[model samples]
Target: TKSLSSNFIKNIVVEDLASGKVKEIVTRFPPEPNGYLHIGHAKSICLNFELADEFKGRTNLRFDDTNPVKEDVEYVESIKQDVAWLGFEWDGLFFASDYFGEMYDRAVLLIRKGLAYVDDQTPDQIRETRGTLTSPGQDSPHRNRSVDENLDLFARMKAGEFSDGEKVLRAKIDMASPNVNLRDPIIYRVLHAHHHNTGDAWCIYPMYTYAHPLEDAIEGVTHSICTLEFEDQRPFYDWVVRECEMPATPRQYEFARLNLTNTVMSKRKLKLLVDENVVDGWDDPRMPTISGLRRKGYTPDSIRAFCREIGVTRSFGIVDERMLEHFIREDLKLKALRTMAVVQPLKVVITNYPEGQTEWLDAENNSENPDMGHRQIPFSREIYIEQDDFMDNPPPKYFRLFPGNEVRLKHAYFIKCEEVVKDADGNVIELRCTYDPETKSGSGFTGRKVKGTIHWVDASNAVPAKFRLYEPLITEEAEEEGQSFLDHINPNSLQVLDGFVEPAMKEANGGDKFQFFRHGYFNVDPKDSTSDAPVFNRIVSLKSSFEV
Candidate 1:
């Protein structure tokens, strides 16, 4: 229940409240349900909902489903789930299609007032005539159609008497204006496709540029927040509400959209990644989509905290991806259960210990948070340690399991490597070691000290697990001029390993997260994990050099 930090958008709301320019502020998170919501959308979601909540105002969750070609019920439901998972409940749920009737009435009013007309020009022709930044646009030949004729054609177009793309209704704004968006923008178009919400109720649909403003007005939205790319369209947004004489006028504000280093933020590009199987699906942990992050073990609190730390601003820049990783590590450090998992196991035999002997050693669940209590771990004659922990011939300052070197087994006793056992291929397959009973962890023994401490699981009770290590999904630098973003797809983004964890973790349910001692934080994959065999996705490494 933390309050949002101050930002430009918050400042605007404060001034509006003090001056009584608005009685009660109303905000909304309106997403076009064309694809899955990504991390970039999380920033907007937190902004609108948290801002409204902080002000004791109401926020609505609305869908701008104007284009039936791309929108679907699946995207709508997924959006709702993402919002809820992020810890917000909207005051009202609505869709733009809910006001199609009123939108048609507004369009008719535009035509009647000589502010709009039906154009027979093709989409390509309209685009060519829109003009450049320094050049003035040419007026359409059909711009001066009679109001009665325009209304009649529009009605007929809605009645399905005309084919798709045959004609469109455009606002009669200044064609010679410097802002190209005001140069007679299309407000309505003929789309014969069936809508997911409205079914076949109407053949004609309003354009997003037109529907967005009216939807805001209809919902009594005091401030329409959007990304910086829509700054130019603000002029048209205001013009529509003013010229159409909407009872409620909503003002639009623009803020910088999120851009992350080594990742593409475009939904179009993400959809392509999904369609082409570049990823397993939208929920692939390597993806930046909200579902992907959730499946990868990111907590809602971490994401919300991250969004707040970034703050809101009009300036644009790419955030270092490490900053995000830093937040997750901070969020999970004290909360995740501390345990040992050998991702690449190398068998170590305590050569002098009695055979068939297993001792349960005490280990702290979370040393930083003692309230989490402690658990017992099995230590036995045969154990599995990381294969990387041992070396036949190590360099100077090498502290781990080299022959004749001593190291402490975490929560157990100090052990010295006596011999190395290798396969015929000359690969070290196992190690023979000796443990000193006097050097057991927490035994208050000052006999000696070792420079290294490594974690291991008793081979007798070790549960087989699958550990997935992840790297950046996009390996190359940000896209260069004329290069496709897909060209940078990291071939080694995911490295799966067959490993073993403590027996206590066998019953860990899906979504349960843990810290694998020095390995890192990991989560049970909700989609692929089963009760019998658990699969862990490495959420992040135990430590990072990334500073705030």
Candidate 2:
């Protein structure tokens, strides 16, 4: 795991610890259990956990599952898995539901203190009276309810006396407050839904804005860090904690959330895609969810390193997506086994080579990593090469195979194309070539030279496999006017093709990563791949124009 990068948060943490302001640092990764955690969340995960670890502190993995209507246990479990997969061990496992009783008591105390009341206004009415940025909000008629009356109504609301949306518990803050968030925001709402955790124990559920602060303070989180969108809500967060008379006070801090090009970070939109089956599921290789990135062959090391390099800042900008791809390549460069895979195969028959004999040729596993050692590849009379590596009519600088063209076979002898075997309709199906055994690889022969070297799989012992090539699910980084995000979905986001790999890959287990000779880095599919027919997802291509 990479060390947490220095940022404003780290500096604040350092100052707090040095001045004896905080004896022990405590942080929390609070995720709403509504959908799968995405790469955007990964940034926050790294920040919270690594920050606490750096100071010899503790971080809690907290589920902010206040909205039962949208939250689920599946999401809660997924979040836990994603955090652990990212290499973090939470010091405490908590849920907002754990403090539901305390939150209700706090609301009751607010009612007794005349700091909160039950607002009977409809949802639309409340929204309308909340006024826009340029205007002051109008006060509700019930805003002046006596503390005794509010207590009775709130108790009834909690006892299921009212249907959903009949009455809402609103803080009796400023009605004409310039900061609209403080304009008597609703602290609790009546929602008649079964909670995944609590399960219909109460009809009145506390709003996230109210429950979040109390939860942080209850757990003694020294610094309440959150994304910038919540920055404006910081005052309200403070108001809740202070008015509730929590024993501990936690300061709120905000940093910019992650935004990446050609990626969607919103959970609402991600859940929509899953519901509509636009992709396979939340873990589809194309989605930006942490599980999706995992299924797509991205290593935690690469992701953690990427998060560290990005740094924590309040600046808002879209990070180049290529920068992410660059880190994955660096992470897997010398580690992944380099092998040969013929994605679109063309049969090549060595006419002059021995007919029924196969020989084991030594092939370097990784040219750049000598410690990886070498593996023997089978060579025989027939092999399968990529269909794109040949052309009937050569371009000006085409150095690959063509009629009568000589090219070196990787880790083998030189071969000259003697004849092209095609179907009646003029589709080139096969090539008849003759190998020059004198130019065998590792022979140190310098008599002849060839500009092109191509990788091939032995036809007799090749493993039949499928390769899935992926592209950005979103075609356009920015949605144009008059189009929804769905309209910008790429039509060709995923393409599957039959391929052949060396016999050694026949036993390749799911999640195993390898670098195909000239194709790209690929990961075996964990869910669908079997020994009979292995499936590989192309992680990335061999060459890229992106640089760190």
Candidate 3:
């Protein structure tokens, strides 16, 4: 975490400390272990960890595993890895299941105080009776159960005497209240599924609305922060703490969640994409999950800096995705190694050069940073250039290779096209060029200059590699009123090309990143690269029109 910036949350914390309302700050990030964490979760993680760090306080990582039907140990482990990869450590690790016994006792206390009762209505009946926004809900016939009867029924419900959904405990709040959340909300239900944390110890589970507030209060949290979608639940959150007579009172605050253009942040939709095989997996490079971004070559420093730049606010807005690409390019400009790669190979034969001969040329690893030093590249009689760099019929002001044009090779002598070889289909397959030895690069011969300079690889020592280019997974246009988001999936999102790169890159390992001379920054694919051959995934383009 870096220094605290000027934001609404920081201002509240500052005032709290100045007025002696809070002696020490304690915050937490509570995530349900049902699916992988997405980029939206990254904002909450940064806000919680950095805010506590700024005040010399502590933060906890807690799993609100209230629903066991969808929870798994696999998701739990992935969440832990994502947080550590983001460069932060939790002071304490906890789970909602850790307080199951205490939560049960609190529910019993509610029954004894006549604040709750056991309702025998089915799930459908309960929802139907819950009135609309403009009307008041009717009271349940079983709302007046005696304290003794309610306790006995609740105990039997927890003891596995009843089937799932046969009985439920509900708080006896006013159904006529304007807020629908206070309309006698369900607190506990019978679920016969085995929990990932407590196993068969629990047959009935508490609802998330009931478990969340108790978890925060029991942990002695000073500030409970969440997204704006949960703003409506804050009233019930406070009601639980007050009615249960918890020793600590934790206040809840809501901030706007992160939304990015051309990306869906919903975990349900992302899980569907993984389950339906629409993507490779949760870690697919095109997905917006943290693991996906990590596999795509985003660094921790860049993500943290972006979160800091966005800041915390109460208003909702969508951020353009190009802004994120801008930060990564800035972070890597001086760090990534600069090299040459010909992704679309066009064969070229230097007729005037010596046959079966090669020479080594010196090139800087990264011209922007001098301390990286220079590297050696082999130049031979046969070379490969970009297929797009040649033209059969030259257009006006075209600077690349043509019938009578001369162009300088990146680090070698100037070459002029003399002959073009065509195949049966009239497609130019090869070019025969002659080099002027006096006009070699790095020499003092500045007699003339060519308008075009292209990068190439020596054919004798080139390494075959696979290059993957990507576009936006979702289309730029907004969806129509009645169309599904899946209808807008781009069919041409990924394009794979067989290419050749410098021999020095043959030994590059997974997670290594580099910048191709005219291409973009790329990462060695960790999932598919081997020592004999390498696969590169383009991180982002070399330039963008986005400002700040």
Candidate 4:
């Protein structure tokens, strides 16, 4: 099989095919059901699933749910949904807990063969005796137990005869090996907590290192793909599979994990962001969770494109945030509808229009897609424009608004700022503008070319809405050295603006996407939105050209 590109993992797979070392590619995405999938997981998911699909193979969705202390059914369902949302399907869904019985039997096999023993040392004592990277470890007194004694003790441990953390079964590997993981690693331990999927049927659980390879073998997975952090553990993984005499051995390949700028991918840190109420919840628009991205108006195709562009590699680096925004902008340009919203509104009165009469103006739904068609927007004598679009005094290069300055009202007629009114605080309260009846947009407004054009909503037809703006969650690089991720928490990642929009916005249901003409990309929030009071979340700013 020829690889699509030069990624090291793909190269390895190609060679495997050419050598006839493997007949069909089999890959698995094994994630612990501890936290919701973030952007990093998207990369891994795409890599394994895409490769398998390309090679006419299949991918398995396996939950490494060995640690019941933090795993739950809620996370399991979330993982499944996220994977499916990413446009991938599992050949079969399996759990490490599902194979606990066979894993325990394998441990018993190793014990009866005098290849393993139960260690009673405390965790700290074991750690201290394990020695350092440059030193050799001393053997434990319990390491020399007879095969029958070890088998009896291990069986008794499984029958609920041992307390949690009191004893652990370890592989009788070389104690003086240079690699610490090869120095008699723990294969199983007594975790008395009830499993989420297996329930209280068993108290003894196998360690991750001992279970992962076995699961892959039993499923006939040809390749076990994971991040670079597990490169060293591959040896121990092979040892477990080969010694257990599994029917087949699956090779493990390593790639660099995705690290993005201005975000934290650590599960523990993300949990803090949720528990502290720093944001609304896990699905907060500012969060990096899959649900958060979905709520923020990000399309799955855009995320998939990002993963495809980033490619797979053993070399690691932090990807720029602007690249993500770039793909999102490219995706929404043709999909989200266009509308006029007055975020910081300033009153403007068209003195020439009829006082009591209102008319409907035609507006394009999406300029990029002609088939999307158009809608009628209300236009009246009184209107509201952006407060920052006007100036009380004239300034150079300011084309928006000023006394005697002419500008076109987007989709409407040309207007001139005739007068300005001030309040008691000496602040510009209103702008009195004069409109030209003959200069209506698309109605032969060709006598003069307006330097600037602005968006507005009819005062009588404006709908009240809640606008949410988001910034980066963290100010520092995600993979920076010696820097605490908490130190970079942006105090103002989210700011809510009580603003107004066109009356058509009032009919918008949750999950509808729209662009606030020259403002930014926004979506109707599925949470806390209704027909009367629409809540909009800013997906990304149009002005933010995040250059690397």
The CA lDDT of each predicted structure is 0.92, 0.93, 0.90, 0.87
Candidate 1 or 4, higher lDDT?
A: 1
Candidate 1: Cα lDDT at 138: 85
lDDT of 3 by residue, 1-548 (tens): 23355368888888998998988888999999999999889989999999899899789999999999999999999999999999989998999999999999999999999999999998778888889899999889999999999999999989999899999999999889899899999999998999999999988899998999999999998889999988999999999999999999988989999999989888888898899787889988888899988878888787887888788889999988887888788888999999889999999999999998999998888989998899999998999999889998988988999987999998888999999999999989999999999988888779999999999999999999998888877885477899877888888778889989999999899888899988989988889987678899888999999996
lDDT of 1 by residue, 1-548 (tens): 22334368988999999999988888999999999999999999999998899899989999999999999999999999999999999998999999999999999999999999999999889999999998988889999999999999999999998898999999999998888999999999999998999999989999999999999999999989999999999999999899878999888999999888877787899999999899999989988899999999999999898888888889997888788888889999889999999999999999988899888899999989999999999888999999989989999998998999999999999999999999999999999999999998888999888999999999999998999999988888667899887888889999999989999998899999999988899999998887667899999997778897
Tens-place lDDT per residue, model 4, 143-167, is: 9999988988898889999999899
The segments of candidate 1 whose C-alpha lies over 4 angstroms from its true place after superposition are 1-6
Candidate 2 residues lying further than 4 Å off, grouped into runs, are 1-6
Clashing residue pairs in candidate 3 are none
TM-score of 1: 0.98
How close is every model to the real structure, measured as TM-score?
A: 0.98, 0.98, 0.97, 0.96
Off by over 4 Å in 3: 1-6, 476-482
Over 1-548, each residue of candidate 2 has an lDDT whose tens digit, in order, gives 22334478988999999999999999999999999999999999999988899899999999998999899999999999999999999999999998999999999999999999999998889999999889999999999999999999999999999999999999989978888999999999999999999998989999989999999999999988899999999999989989999999898999999999899989999998899899999999999999999999999999998899888888897888888888889999999999999999999999998989999999999999999999999999999999999999999889999998999999998999999999999999999999999999999989989999999999999999999999999888787899889988899999999989999997899999999988989999999998889999998888899776
Q: What does candidate 4 score on TM?
A: 0.96
